[model samples]
Target: MKTANEKKNKMTTSEKTSKYLMPNFGVRDFVVSGGKGSWLFDDKGEKYLDFGAGIAVTCLGHAHPRWAKAVAKQAAEIAHCSNLYMTRQQADLAEKLVEKLGPGKMFFCNSGTEANEALIKAARLYGKKVTGAEGKKFRIVSAIDGFHGRTLGALAATAQEKIQKGFAPILQGFSYAKYNDLKSFEEQMGDDVAAILIEPVQGESGVTPADPKFLKGLKALCKKHGALLLFDEVQCGIGRGGAFLTSQKMGVKPDGVSLAKGLGGGFPIGAVWLAKPVQDIFTPGTHGTTFGGNPLACAAALETLNVIEKEKLCENASKMGERLGRGLEKIAKKYPGKIRLTRGVGLMRAVLFTEQYPNAAVCKKLRENKLILIPAGCNALRFLPPLNVKASEVDKALNIFEKTIERL
Candidate 1:
């Protein structure tokens, strides 16, 4: 008995997504229409506090006026001219990144996966340069739980069996090492190994941070063996770790760094920074991307970095990180056996629940309470709020989290 318009209006967004899109993601019922700073509005006009921040991609929060304005201005001027010709925006962005990351050259891409892939290729080229052979010295050693990307080349670098399950015949010459174990990496390293790739802060695998001493050890080891030390900072860089790069905060210099996510503040962009020693390894025709470092993408990334510095968001992240850490610890104490542990650095944090309460269940309950979170690993939920998040917002989120835990 319903009219056609009414029937159409009654159809939920989840239903449309299920019908039209691939079933790769475990789609939730929440349908986001719009968002403001630290908050998202569902199609029903219900607002939810967004702690996940689009998986740590929205560093400036939703619809930031300055960011939006810069993107609009750039789009009006020029959007995609391809990588055939260079633009001032691209040049300026590259200069800024090189200055921040030390003596390095920058290569732009469209996502973290692409950035990591570029680094892998750079490592291979360096290997061939050093050994004077193509496939002889092209092995890469990565952490057992580290995640590089979904592409075959990147997936081979990633050591998780779950992520690499269906992808057969993954690129060869990749080795695995235990995270935070210097001896394990030493065993994997040899004259044939080109580089060691790892995440300083493993965001996807429960927000575990690499020990400072461990990273320093790897640096020395790489130097001893003429192997490159590459940090996958895709999730922890660009002010997320209370510093521009986690390697900088730890005082360990890596040969190369791959970054994305927060770099564009919700816009799609990625970059790889290679130190001067290996910077010239890539020739003109060796690698290229059509949309990488275009004017519009460079504009977004440049403005994102500018805002972070001007607003002192990195300093804010440090302070708020301390506050959030204390809050999580207190909650952990309140429910003795419920939480196994809480860990992370800066705004990238996680709460590992006991086996009794699964991460998915807790995430669902938090979403039901209008507090969104991202499930990580097997039993942890990540809290990756924006860098500019206020103390009051942190308190509100904590209160909601505590209430949800009590109910469970």
Candidate 2:
């Protein structure tokens, strides 16, 4: 039934993917051709409401005008230059971040994993400096079920066994503690402890926000042991949780913070902000990246921040998040047995389901129904819409969610 021209122009999803891409990820049935606002369009022209926002990377939404303009302008000017030279865009972005995140110095990288790796290196250097060159104070404590990244150093900091299955002999000096339990964390702390790293909100484990009291206690414990406190805000930072940094809302300051995801507004970028005391640990030769603070990436990030501020997207996230939570609660009430609970802050929300319905199945069904949502551990579905999401889109997603539950 197809014309010769149409057949020539078309290629099956399998044909397009099987040849070029790695087999690590399971590719979806449809190929995404384009996206706008909170919607994505597939090659077959099916429209999907994107609640995942590329796993919380596109905080300003798809194809945002200002972000596109900034990237285009910068690309035309200068897309990339090695770190050997300084670029105005990169410096400007750094200044903006430092101004927003308190007095600190920042190091740029390509992703969250790299940022956490930098944090790890910085912590170890600080430890060596404080406790002498041959000191044993290099162990870093992280939380159970917390996700950092897949790289060796960051993976070592991550506490999931499944992710570390075959990649054993992970870098030494990493310990695990129970999240949200101060006593469990204390058990891991010692004179040799260099840093305590945690996520403000555990996005991968299921939208688990850190308890304010637990964060405060950890800070105190770190100080007592002469260790640094590091927050991996990759998933919760850059206005994702109604604040530039979740620690700001929690009223606890970390000695260092790793950020990525929404910081670049879909461009690949990462950063680590270090407080004054330990900021200078990384001397000239200690750490570096080839294309970290390139002009195009910084321009995209700067514009993302500008839009977030000018449009007051943080305030919007809080308001819309409340609306979203209320809607989910109402749905939970309607399907008491199917839905167990809902949790999260700002737009980073989740719906926990009963054992009868598995989270993976729920996510698959949602995708089939032209809705996109991410599955977290613990039988939960995460909703990480853009910070500038509209109330109407939230309602539409809720309607689809309710119908999906009914069918299930």
Which candidate achieves the best TM-score against the true structure?
1
Poorest 10 consecutive residues by lDDT, candidate 2: 11-20
Give the candidate number with the greatest lDDT.
Answer: 2
Per-residue alpha-carbon lDDT of model 2 for 249-368, expressed as tens digits? 899999999999999999999999999888888999999999897899899999999999999999999899899999999999999899999999999999999999999899989999
TM-score, per-candidate, Cα-based: 0.97, 0.96
**Error at 168, model 1, angstroms:** 1.2
Across 1-408, the per-residue lDDT of candidate 1 in tens digits comes to 999889877877877788778988866677789999899999889999999999999999999889999999999999999888879999999999999999979999999999999999999999999999899788999998898888888899889989999878889989999999999999998989899999999888789999999999999988888999999999999999999997799899999999999999999999999999888877999999999999999999999999999999999888898899999999998997889889898999999999999999899999999999999995999999999999999999999999999889
Clashes of each: 0, 0
The total number of steric clashes, by the backbone 3 Å criterion, in model 1 comes to: 0
Model 2 CA deviation exceeding 4 Å by range: 1-11
Give the C-alpha miss distance for residue 381 in model 1, angstroms: 0.3
Off by over 4 Å in 1: 1-11
* lDDT of model 2, residue 225: 99
